[model samples]
Target: MDSITFRSDTVLSDVHMYTPNIRHLMVRLNAVGQPVFVSKFRILRNINVCSKDDIGDLGNEENRELVGVNNASTSRVDCSNTMANEKKDEEKKETAATEILLDDDGDLDVPRRPSDFVNSCEKDLWREKVYPTIISKGEEVPFEEYDEDWSICNDIRIEHTMDTTLEDVGKQIWRGAFLLADYILNNTYLFRGSTVLELGAGTGLTSIVMATVAKTIFCTDVGEDLMNMCERNIIVNKHIYGAAGGEIKVRELDWLRDDLCTDTKNPYCWSEEEIAHLYDYTNVLLAADVFYDDDLTDAFFQTMYRILSNLKNRSITYLSVEKRLNFTLRKMDVTCDAYDHFRLCLADLESINDGKTKFIVEAIKLTFPQFLFYERVEQLELWKIIAEPLISNTQQ
Candidate 1:
């Protein structure tokens, strides 16, 4: 059985656009002719009063990883009664999996209004012959042209991948970013005029959103290509925060490294002044959906400790993570080890009493108002860590 399919002609590009109204960016094909388009995350004006009649339930399967864009298709394999029939079905499974076979009778409904948000439930519905169309780019785009209204003041335009590998997941938008963005937008007083540092700020979406309210934002992540793309996003979305005089400095920060990159020859290296400002002035830290691998989770906490312990003022770190469940052959059941490890790291940090600094962990309730338009999942969580230095007798 062919379980995995690979596309060999994928090419990444940096050609992105931003218009005056901040809508209708041109979708450009990469070197391999794959379409790359802009994903606009609209802000919900009144989520409480929004009509639930049209909005369907977004369960765990629908909101897997709670990422902003879900590209995977779901297919169900039916077992035949006879061995000959089973063999024939197996032969055609590959082709059937790739295409949306809505019904056994081959009947499809009239295409409805386009969906800006893509989820897994729609894919499952297609397999069950209950849905009309998938709203994502490629193969099934409803319109010939890309004209849609995004004149809303709070909509966030992000450059993302129509197709991506597991390694390139950071280049896409995640729902954790939306959760944090909601918290930031709803509780503006917590970050108003504050110097904020966002670790693992992939695509700089959260940082860009934060810049609209915060005084200064340090959007830090590794990889030259990824950082360049993030800087481009910061440039594209500058109009949202530029009028308010909010500044976002895209810098390179590797979680595995103990020291900030200070080499003057490097393009994304940090300056002495910026480093000082980070340790002295930054009062808040933010991270969204960066905890997946065990090794990286360990490195992230270590880096957080180093930054929080040396801060000049009492600082708080807000972390957002979607508890991802997967079936492991070893366990033979669904598990969420990465999220468990993250909770373990939080416990260790809170238990640390080295006499120099203190760490306190708290789980923020998700009762905050929704600002961005996305399928909010229960697995999506927000955690807060408050770090304060302990004053000794000599200091007192």
Candidate 2:
């Protein structure tokens, strides 16, 4: 039976003595049809029980302007779950937060910082540190820079500096870039006497490292501001890059543009002169830490397909990215949306394959000498991509 019933009588019972009980009684009655009671006994004082965690984070000036992350949403209480499950989960989380934030424990779940927001993806805090290293050329800096991390290779010094409060994530250097750089340093034979292009070359570190080995290195990103910064870095390290028999040029490449993969004569497509300059030097492609978001992952591959397309010679790609395993506040569990999206794109390659055009991706074995002082963590991986079946049909 429903908790509500028609009370035709005007006489009130003891159950109606309490204000809380009367409030619920009125609500239940109104749920059916009690407009008469609604007006006569209008709700005046309402009590809503809330927890300390119910209030969401209202971002500050420095917070909202950050790039690659949206404004955080507010947190609210959910009444759907039974109290038992909620209580148990709360206790488990208290333990999880303390043990998960650092690298030691297998648990990667960072604890909530006692914020009002119910769900926040800002669990992975931004941190900066100067890493010391000696490149294959046997170069090392004894003193670490106070603000920037400086890595020297073949007389070229690349300062890896980052401030988390910025909007352009492409401006920051990631671990994957360093991993790729180390690989290039060890295997200079693959890149020597060849032109190389790096996609999403944040901070241009990988390109700078590769320029020491390759013939000519093209460092490309999306924004003029980012490209300007990349150019400055390349200029600062120009001596070493030139010393290695390569010159550097920065370009703005938006991978999502329809013209990138299409032969259309749209303004967004690379100019004929630009394509002529870049097309001839087809040897290897490099990208690092470019697969962090699902929105850009497919476009990234699309750009790869466009470049690797119509190629008569073989082109190899080395993509190194660190897998993020942070716990999602919205998912309430672990999720790998970026990597999952990548796999999904790979699985549906039939559209791209079409027999005539196809890309074959293979996991580059980790047998290469562990190049980093920290070595490659389980999170970072390198993939060797090859343009298969060749481009037999090309109109000269």
Candidate 3:
């Protein structure tokens, strides 16, 4: 055979790195030679309360009041007027808070400490620090007024790719992951102490976020390169969710394959014990933005059915997808073919009359609070699937 040489760095040229904030983290390469960069997502505890001015002082009493402190002793008429003013001011403050929470370029503003929330007297002390002068003296000036002991809470760091081809898109982050992560953060009680399985986890961002509340997480995907990257993300973000006693295991799960990988040579293969635990203890399933391809969508449902049928208990799945409109040559107009096909598959799944399993599908309302920062486009949607095995199927 003729000599055939492959360049390892060629993939690096096609790879792009992304980080939401300005701070830089260490970068490393995956098994496939793609450069992986860490992206930090600052989690918001309360969307309605957080503002640019009250960032790190989430529960601080001194800066907690929405309305200004008013006279304690007042007449009934004055009290009524004050109530109206407070209501109006509260609305305006909430709006402003939402607006200034993120900067123009969508970067989270630098976190501020409780001490940084200063009064008029302390403003002059840090005036020069906030606005540095280009024409400074030879000696370096120290910033004593501003608190340097600031720390961010619930910060989730994910290893992901910035730009790549559609085939390697799973290495990049998507809005669906953010939406799912937000839902988990908003309603942690539902997933608390639950054994969760995340399908097509990609960079494993949503899985990491779920680990904060879920007791156990099986973050599954295909390919060695992607699996390695996902495992690395779980390691970097362990500090955020590990304290809660949550555990995450990364494994290779190919939707195209009929059986789980059991080969000992495969590093990402599942153990016999893990496979048993998955079918016995898993109570929840999750998938984010994995419905773009028709063939993959079909395989995903097959895998879903196989896993759900094998589960010992009824399990619920939360799937998030972003509808992308494209001008197709066949349609010759704006259409979401991939999304339409996904809906068809879902309908087929629900319409199944198989004596073994029952699938119920429902559209989840998007009214839930958003805890993660992202452009939750109108096309983004969340669907809930409840898979219950019949008595006969369970007995088998």
Candidate 4:
């Protein structure tokens, strides 16, 4: 948006009259083409002067008069009088135009008033508020308009949560999620016909993308409100997944809750029984950004373990988590080392299974500038773990 600055005492007619102070007025332009004045002083005293015709150059005949003495004098008078009358006529037309422009559905085009200009500014700010921020390397990266039709991946489906309360904290989907989802989708053989489950599926962008290739997807999140929002986004973009013929089921899966295995209570939970239904047809499980809290990590892994072991055949779980370095440092004094804690926990679990559970952990380093359009944002590496169950001796 643009800002226009002028002196408060400046009269409407004074704009038509040549004044040095008002000659170099600054105007702020908005996205909607409205101009706003941002000076501490109240400029442009009369709103009536802010009409369509009055916005442009003032008619001055002295500059247009010729040089010859006799003709110049007479011409000057005639020109001055003519210009004066013309200015009056223009003013009348401007008044009529202003009236029409102010009408609810008027056809006349006119410059926006100061109030209208301010309203447009507020709207633009609101848009900025809702827009997501991409952060990498501890900095905020800029966002660009995404134009790719990512649903074309034959083996994967993607769903996006364009709106979220995280916007309240200025956190939104970054390019890291997009890149990972795109990579998995393009590698169709890895995900196609697989029964996939996405945790913390905010806006379900990744899940929707995966659903394109997955046979059946259980997109789960923690809250009912978020689940409903996710469902709405899926319905709005149903046409994108038309080619893949994948099914997307959005449900609430609270990580802290149990009893998901039974059909009677907590049916929304993801349990072995639910996994069994898809055992013959399912192959892989996926989750993104599901490791914000260490307390929840245990339950998250336990749930995955149960799901993996319950499958009749082999199944794999791919989890992507952006390590919060800040949280790690803060919690260091209160708990065991962050990285060691996770490793020891996994080791203990492996001991219980007698090494029957195989887990492979890899770190994917992502560049901040590559993932974000803004230079201020930082990038960090995301940790991905691929977990599978060891075959029994008899089966081997």
For all predicted structures, in order, the TM-scores are 0.69, 0.56, 0.71, 0.49
At residue 200, what lDDT does model 1 achieve? 92
The residue pairs in collision within model 2 are: 55-116, 67-167, 75-118
Lowest lDDT block of 10, candidate 4: 67-76
Task: Evaluate all candidate structures by whole-model CA lDDT and list the values in order.
Answer: 0.65, 0.51, 0.68, 0.43
**lDDT per residue, candidate 3, 141-189, as tens digits?**
1222212221224566566754466677788788888889888987888
- Model 4, span 101-149: residue lDDT tens: 3334322222323223334334433221111122222221111222224
Q: Runs in model 4 with CA error above 4 Å? A: 1-176, 261-275, 327-352, 364-379, 382-386, 391-396
Residues 1-396, candidate 2: write the lDDT tens digits.
222232334222111121111111111111112211100110001101211122112122231121101011111112234433544454344333323222343222222232312232222121111121212231221222212222232233333222222335665456677678768866878888877878999778789878877877767777655565567567766655666678776766778775432234332235566566677765788998888677798898877777777555677889897777769999999888887777676666535655656677778776554222222557778888776644463642
Which of 1 and 3 is the better model by lDDT?
Answer: 3
Q: Give lDDT tens digits, candidate 1, residues 254-363.
A: 99899999998778899999999998899999999988899999999999999888888889999999898999999999999999999999999999988878999999
Candidate whose lDDT is highest: 3
The best-first sequence of candidates by lDDT reads: 3, 1, 2, 4
For each candidate in turn, give its C-alpha RMSD to the true structure in angstroms.
12.9, 22.9, 14.7, 22.2
Judging by TM-score against the true structure, name the best candidate. Answer: 3
RMSD of 4: 22.2
Candidate 1 wrong stretches, greater than 4 Å: 1-26, 29-35, 45-152, 392-396
